[model samples]
Target: MRVLTVNAGSSSLKLRLLGPNDEVERSTDAEPGVDLEEVLRAWPAPEAVGHRVVHGGTRFTEPIVIDTGVRKELEDLTALAPLHQPKSLAGLDAVTAQLPEVPAVACFDTAFHTTIPQAAATYAVPGEWRERYAIRRYGFHGLSHAWCSARVARFTGARRIVTAHLGAGASLAAVLDGRSVDTTMGFTPLEGLVMATRSGSVDPGLVLWLEEHEGLSPREVAETLEKRSGLAALAGKADMREVLAAAGRGDAGAVLALDVYVHRLAAGIASMAAAAGGIEALAFTGGVGEHTPEIRARAAERLAFLGLAVDPARNDTNEGEITAAGAAVRTLVVPAREDLEIARGTRAALR
Candidate 1:
């Protein structure tokens, strides 16, 4: 079956055509001016279109055939993920407008972590907030976590693994028996380790303090935490490459940013390792994890107590296995494959 997988982001749209063999037939990026119709028309007629919906909330636990009720529920989730949901829904509409006869399925990024226990998913909020509002942890980065876990299983033939998907929006996952038992991102993608622009975790008192001292509203506080904090606030830039360059030039702010980012990352990974009882192997996937050798080296340095260390020469290059010969656990860098994952999910749903 030919499947068209759509991953619509806030500012970009990525679409890939996958055949029955699970290989990419064609892939392209569309900008604001690009015609969605022309893009879909260029690909061979797909049997189905699978969408990567960013937030499923509590309504969807698996891939579903889109209908009126499904569409409305998806729309309702837009408030949860304001940045990506609108674009995802628009991508779905665009695909349907072009290929009305083909089946369309919605696969969620939150579905993989649905099995996390209540203890890990809940917060220390009041009972009314916990039970009435569903105010609890709903981790993100599930798609990347799922893909890396499967890849680690295929590569090392191991059942227990820890996969860190570090990028602009970073998160770590603990996979036990090929299932996600715990993860770093929580509730609103802002309750774990620091990220490119999002403040991973902050004291609630800080929000009230800002509100009283600066006369800021709750929405302004949200924007600052989500858009203006993290690496950007720490080092004046969100890109790790720029941050490293500045640090190399002896910028104190940049240096501090790097230290905090790496330290927090290591702490989060250690927690995941503990959750798995002992990590069999560590897989790194995502933009930073796959490309930034310095970050990988630093993170592995912090994990040496666990018998994890990366070979200098191997890490300098972008090779997969960066672990030393005598290391207890393998350290690897695997590029993420979310499009193929979505297509596979859709194929299974069709079956």
Candidate 2:
């Protein structure tokens, strides 16, 4: 079955046609408003369509055929993931309209994390609040994590690994035997390791203090953390390349930002290892993970305790394996491939 996968970002739309066995027949990158006919004109008609929905909340845990009810539920979830949910819904609408009769599936990024135990998924708050709000950790970047887990297993033959999806938005996953036991992202993408623009985990007390003492409103706090903070707030920009450039020039703010970024990243990786009992390997994906050699080296140096030394030579290259020959635990670099996983899920849901 050929599956056309749609991943709509804030400014761009990515389309992929995956063959029955997951081979990419063709792909395209177009502006967000491009017509669906243009995306499909170059390829044969797809048997199905899979969309990358960022949030499913608690109700939808698996890929399901997109129907009227599913669309309504997704619309309801818009507030939960204000950044990505609307774009995903818009992508779904485009594909559904273009191929009205095609079987469409909603492959959620949160679906792969449904396996997290309640202890890890639950927020430490009042039962009343938890029950009333359905507040809990719903991990993000799960499709990337799932793809890393599967690909790393095939490459390293390890049952337990910490998979880091580091990019503009970053998260780590503890995968045991191909299942997600625990992950870094929680309730929202804003809670986890340091990201490009968003501040990761911040104390609840600090948030309350901002609202009460600093006289910042709830909306102000959200906007600050989600957009104004992180590397951007620390240095002057959010782009990792620019941050690194400034850091290289001995800029104190950039230097401090890099240190804090790597520190939180190493801590998250170690936390994930603990969640999996012990780490047999570590897998890196996403833009930063696959490209930033310095970030990987810094992280691996801090994690030397786990014997995860990266071979400087291998780390410089793009091949999957990056671990030193004698390191106890392997380190790998896996490029982001959420669309492939989306295709796999869509096929499974229909088959």
- lDDT per residue for candidate 1 within 43-159, as digits (tens), equals 788999999998898778778888889999999888777777888898888778888899999999888888877777778889987877667777788888898889889988877
Q: Which segments of candidate 2 are over 4 A away from where they belong?
A: none
Least well predicted 10-residue stretch by lDDT in candidate 1 = 316-325
The window of 10 residues in a row where model 2 has the poorest summed lDDT is 32-41
**Predicted model with the maximum lDDT:** 2
lDDT of each: 0.87, 0.91
Runs off by more than 4 Å, candidate 1? none
Candidate 1 Cα lDDT to native: 0.87
Indicate the residue-level lDDT of 74 in model 1. 94
TM-score of 1: 0.96
Cα lDDT of model 2 by residue, 179-238, tens digit? 999999898899989899999999999999999999999999999999999999998889
The TM-scores, one per candidate, come to 0.96, 0.97
